[model samples]
Target: MYLLKRRVLQFFTMILLGMLLLVLLYSIDGLIPFLIVIAIAAPLIVGWQILFDQVQPQAKLAWLLAVLFIPFLGALAWVMFGRTPRRHRRVKRTSSEIRMFRQAIEMERIETANAVSDRFPLTRTLQKLGATGADGHTSTKLLVNGEAKFEAVLRDIEQATHHIHVQYYLFRTDDISSKIRDALIKKSNENVTVRFLYDGLGSQEIGEDFIEPLRESRVHVEAFDPVVHPLLVFNANFRNHQKLIVIDGKIAYTGGLNVGDEYLGKEEKLGFWRDTHLRVEGPLVRELQRLFIENWLYAGIEDDKETWDLFANEEHLPEYFIDEPKDSNGATQLLVTSPGKDVTIRDGLMQLMMEAKESIWITTPYLIPPPELLALLEVAGKSGIDVRIVVPGKGDEWFSFHATEYYFEQLLKRNVRIYKYNRHFIHAKTVLIDGKIALVGTANLDFRSMYLNHEMTIAQFETSSVQELHDAFLKDFDESILIDWSILRKKTNGKRFVEAFCHIFSPLL
Candidate 1:
């Protein structure tokens, strides 16, 4: 009934808009001439804008084609969603708070410089891409799927004494979400500071009933770029896709699992969800803490003096922030990317691919790769690196799944092996290289994650956690069916047409 009402409302809204447009057209005699002028000038202006920005060549071409073919709407969309607004760019790059935040971690960088550099040559380049250098004192544990991640999260939330910071791209009102919500409310009742941030577009379906409880319980909540208002709906191009949690400034969790029952294999469609998450302790938790606070501030949440002193500034920094450099088993680094910020994860992954001599194993739900990453994969495969990618046999998204299917032939032609996990839908975003390092986080192998969404990833070097992740990949590969020429030939012509059609719109997806 609610959906029907929404549809009826939307229909009436469109009818009203059409009537208004027709009235304007009839009333203004010079409107046609003005429109013609706009049609001619808009494409030229958009073309110039696209070229001036740091858009990829292929994306630039796509935008140009869009503006040329569908002038008015395309130009309006480009203005609204295509590029980051100037204001966002300024705040992201020039914010004094961010500058002070970076300076706060300078000591960590200097202390780990020699050891991290000697071990990982790409550390310097990654650091330049808005990530901290590898810290040796960190300890990591690999959480295989949503069950393990949620269990660990609930356990840690129960133990949190100081504060609980939780963020998710999607926070549904299912059983698991309620479980976590109830846990958070309990902690808030115990006088623990609870801050919750969620992506407005991703969690738009969540109603006031779900949120009122949190607020009533004194859980500080904010939605990142909320699309609840009609005028704000078009701003859905950019989303905060990171799933993170910080507990007591000591432990952190991040990866692909969000607060949904579908992630727990309760959904009937995408059955038996397969994913990966990580638990971090020691110094890396501090970096994750900084990221949470940065995003919290970005959501426009103001803090009182006591709260600000609890989470911010050098004077009130957590004791866990300045963890002594212990002779740990391995080092860990973080990769964060926002829409207007540096494309840190993409560049870091490409560099990691180039550095991979023995093997490059990837597992992701989406498979749409940017041209640069695709080229790197082709080159690595052709150069005899054991390149293998495992994607979902069943997908929850339509266009992106077909777009993923479109790239199968190109990858196989270059000797890159592909596998479809048939047991269930594999939503893990992971990359294992040379049996030594692993990347596990929220970014997918798609344009949405690499360019549009805010993403965070963790790079684990020679850790026992990496080895565990490596073994998990091996198990998944064993379960998955390999895709070869025979598989490509078996696809129907209609399926091929759908994939090709979807591939054309890959940039927007």
Candidate 2:
């Protein structure tokens, strides 16, 4: 009832404003104002229907309602926030820098990569979607949680040879982060080249004072997508959510765990931070290496000649480490998803699910999915495919938690099994299919990740990697609380109201 009343009132206000504006314009001179309105309004009205083809139906309707009700004001809002315009000079400059920076890392592949693609049709589709291909000669380790991941990272940092490249969305100065920083400083003093990258907006808490020691130690520290103008909020929407660590262009690491004490299960508010991390070797580390360089240069850490300092330093450089594949178990591809890309991480996940004949298991910290994804899962469930999803019982963000809960009933009706990890806040983002292949990375199943942010995911076809992920999923499922109909119906009226309100804007959020 409140929703209806709000809409009714907004519509009336729109009408009143339109009438008042028209009268004021006529009192002065109607000709110019009327002609301008006719030209703009006529095209906007017709072209909006065409624009609907580009966006999702719900998002399209939201844009339509704003335009019809608010008229002139709505048009301004649409231009500002409704579209992802890439015409801005800053955007063009950033793109050019990325192209220039990307040239530093190796991208060639061996023969086995092509063979893997031909053998698996889905990998071909994923390649077309993400502009990535499989690297057959590679090794992987499925790290279960943050503690395991950080321990491995610290050990690897201590053993660094030629160079080290590390990036994270969140870079806190907590105990864990401080320890890692000290290790990097130790490496820098050893004359082994080192570069560290962080997202500006996500790691806003890290001050210049925090990073001063690294700079003084001669370590190249930079931030991606830094806020250029205070008035420009749109730039803030696009974030570098990718967490990557590459050692000497051979060893690589990625997953949900960022550098922080909380991630190591040391924060009291969240008892344990359940997550996953992967350590990869072989041709694919170069892919992660390429992404790190792309961001390091784009962040304007430096410009002009000698732009490839991160990749190359002629003076006092150690030989690049040769991290051969521990075993050629199967193929792995490092798939990158970002704004202005060919397709997306979401597309790859959907294609992966289409190949599932036995079961589809998923886990993520957030669950704000678009309608098409919701429909696909419903259909898959009806077809008797084993469909299961694991999410956090308690989320770090309150609004995100309710927005995820909002889709429960719709999914329940279609027989999709939903489980909430009750022991702690689980942040592992993964997709496993048929016990043969898996996806693990930083992209969460939400609008921000799918449509706006820059993210990464590794498609693993290795039997060992897939088996480990499958076993982990089963363990998490065993410890989870299944969300059946009765439990959902027991929600209080106040909680229901809050969730309902949050659901209305979940897509835009």
Best prediction by TM-score: 1
For 302-359, candidate 1 gives per-residue lDDT tens digits of 4323233345456667443646444467788999988865689998999889999999
**What C-alpha lDDT do the candidate models reach, one value each?**
0.81, 0.75
Clash pairs, candidate 1, are: none
Pick the lDDT winner.
1
TM-score of each model, paired residue for residue: 0.89, 0.83
Per-residue lDDT over 185-279 for candidate 2, one digit per residue giving the tens place of the 0 to 100 score: 99999998888888876776788888999999989887776654323334554678899998877789998888899887888877888899998
Q: List the residue pairs that clash in candidate 2.
A: none
Candidate RMSDs in order: 3.9, 6.3
Q: In model 2, where do residues sit more than 4 Å from their true spots? A: 1-54, 63-114, 228-232, 301-306, 309-323
TM-score of candidate 1 on Cα atoms, chains taken together:
0.89
